[model samples]
Target: MGKVTGFLEFQRLQEAAEAPANRLKHYKEFVLHLTDDQARQQGARCMDCGIPFCNTACPVNNIIPDWNDLVYRQDWSRALDVLHSTNNFPEFTGRVCPAPCEAACTLNINDAPVGIKSIEHAIIDKGWQEGWVKPQVPRIKTGKSVAVVGSGPSGLACAQQLARAGHAVTVFEKSDRIGGLLRYGIPDFKMEKSHIDRRVSQMELEGVAFRTSTFVGSAEDAALFGQGLSTVTPAQLEAEFDAVVIAGGSEAPRDLNIPGRELQGVHFAMDFLRQQNKVVAGDKLPGQTTAAGKKVVVIGGGDTGSDCVGTSNRQGAKSVVQFELMPQPPEVENRELTWPYWPARLRTSSSHEEGCDRDWGVTTKSFKGKNGKLTALECARVEWVRDEATGQMKMNEIEGSVFDVPADLVFFAMGFVSPVQKVLDAFGVERDGRGNARANTDDYRTNRDKVFAAGDMRRGQSLVVWAIREGRQCAASVDAWLMGSTTLPR
Candidate 1:
């Protein structure tokens, strides 16, 4: 530790956010990062807890204490090195990760925990500003060719690691651009696309080839292989590469099976979000739908739904309403019982602060519309209770709580069910009970030999941090399988 009594001397400080009125006008990230001195003070608050649970709590298992100590000692260069050792994309996680590490902090038991996320944000931003972040091109070529499907966080991380290991790596992306969800599903106000652009450049410099608009296992490409893949057809990817890794994210959205689902104005949240992202990227849409002057109703109250609310507000929607099936959670958790674990409690995002009417313990029954366009949603309040015998929670509709809310546009942000079956079926990969790609977390190998799966495709919908972690570990597994040994960190 830099200072024995540093924790006692410094108070926790978080990054500031732009004011609502000023920030709502634009779709740019508005988080104000800490100055160097303030970041050091925040880093000093990392108590010398003997256990260092924050490290384990982090998805990428970042060495939080080491970086915090380094930052506190004003060693910026060493801090960036330590920060980047485990996690490939600190900048992304620093901005959007829920920061479970903070909750696990020992100081969180009685006081504010260390602002580890902000400190990381500072370290990475400083690294970029100082031109310390650069491609680490491998010195020797291994000549082992690897093909990674999907260009999301998982695939990108895997490709980068494999490239640095001196393997010939090619990343295939179905979209026109590299980043999957990060470049589309996420709103710009949360994280700009420039971060992904820079990483893409770095990966290219490190000898990782990116092939955008290349669908590896599309129906047209099925004739290329002899033995077929279980999740993707074997013929499609067989002769092109020595090893194939599937890092495609979960894209099968959970649908609300209700009346008027076919209405023109109703759309999946991702469709709307992706379109907006494309527009921001300078792609013109002739008939793009806008929320302006429309009464928008967003289903699901998770982060995706919150993103919809923010986007709707930015589009000048007449009104925005969000609904959740579960009952509202407490504003604060019972910390004594939930400390050192991610607590289940209410979370209000910046989008919610922009403007929204939130309702919980409610379910939409049907959609009503005119001329094939959605106009209103019929919904009812529900109550949940525990069953005496089974001890399972059950929901029942309230007898007199049914009502209709006007909705000119409806966005379903209910989250994904699994990876699209077409891709998995094309390869013939086996699935678990949840319809996710069935692969072992320990080795990341699928049922098919020479093929592996990771990220949301294997674990279901999860955080970017988890995706990156899976990618890194999966790369190590693949490398070990290819060479019979590997030096890559898990």
Candidate 2:
């Protein structure tokens, strides 16, 4: 610990954002990173809890205490090294992760936790500014080839690691650009694309080849999540590459199949969000679905839903409302009981703070409209009752609780169910009952030999941090398989 009494001396300070009024006019990152002194002070707040639960809580298992002390000592060069030891992309996680590590901080038991995320954001930003981030070209070539499908966080992580391990790695991306979901699914206001661009440059310099607009599946799979300009058969990949890694994210969005789901103006959250991202990248989309000047209602109270709220407001929606079927969680958690673990509690994001009418325990029954255009949503208040047999909560609509709310546009953000089956089937990989690619965490190997799966593709939809962890681990497994042994970290 840099300072034994630092925790008692300083309180946690988070990054500040530009005013909503000003930020809504443009799609840009507004959360200001901490200043050098501020980061140092925040690092000083890291108490010697004897056990750094933040490390375990983080999906990538970052060495939190070491980096904290390094930052406190102003040894930023070493801090960056420590930051990159476990996580391949600290910049991405620092920008968008919800910071479960903070929730598990020992200080969070009774006080505000150390500002670990902001410190990380500061460290990576500084590393870039100082020209410290560079290519890690392998000294020797192993001559083994690897094909990584999907260029999202996980795929990128795995490809980078494999390339560093002296393998000839070629990343196949179905999209026109790299970064599967990060390039399309997330809003630009949260994280600009240039961050991904610079990382791609670094990876390219490290001897990794990127094949964009290349689909690795059967012809019928074109209609699935990733559409490609060119197609490569699974047989071709198997015959050429020594190993194949499926890092494609879970892209099968869960649909609301109630009555009137076919109505126009009702769309999946990704459709709206993806369009905005393309527009920001200078692509002109004709008849683009937007929330401008319309009453908007977003279903599902998750990060995607909050993104819809922020995007809708930015698009000049007249009104925005969010609905969640589950009952509202408490504003605060019982930290005493849930110490050293992620606690379940209400989380109000910056988008919510910008503007939104949020209602919990609300279910949409159907759409009420005419001429195939949505006009309103028929909804009902429901209560969750525990089922004795399953011991799981089931939704029950209350009598006389039905109501209608004006909704010119509706975005369903209920999350994804699984990866597109066509891609998995093309690779001859097995799937779990939940529809995700079936593979154990130990080796991330699928039923098919020379094929492995990781990230959301294997574990279903999860956080970006988790995806990076899986990618790193999967790369280690692939290296071990190809070389009969590997020195890469898990």
Estimate every model's Cα lDDT from 0 to 1. Answer: 0.90, 0.93
What TM-scores do the predictions have?
A: 0.96, 0.99
Q: Where is model 2 more than 4 Å wrong at Cα?
A: 223-228
For model 1, residues 168-248, the per-residue Cα lDDT tens digits are: 998877788889999998999999999999999999999999877666665454333222322234565757788989899
Q: Indicate which candidate wins on lDDT.
A: 2
For candidate 2, the per-residue lDDT at 342 reads 81
**What lDDT score goes with residue 112 in model 1?**
82
Error of 2 at 275 (Å): 0.4
Query: lDDT of candidate 1?
Result: 0.90
TM-score (C-alpha, index-matched) for candidate 1 = 0.96
Root-mean-square deviation (CA) per prediction:
3.3, 1.1
Which parts of model 1 have CA positions greater than 4 angstroms off?
220-234
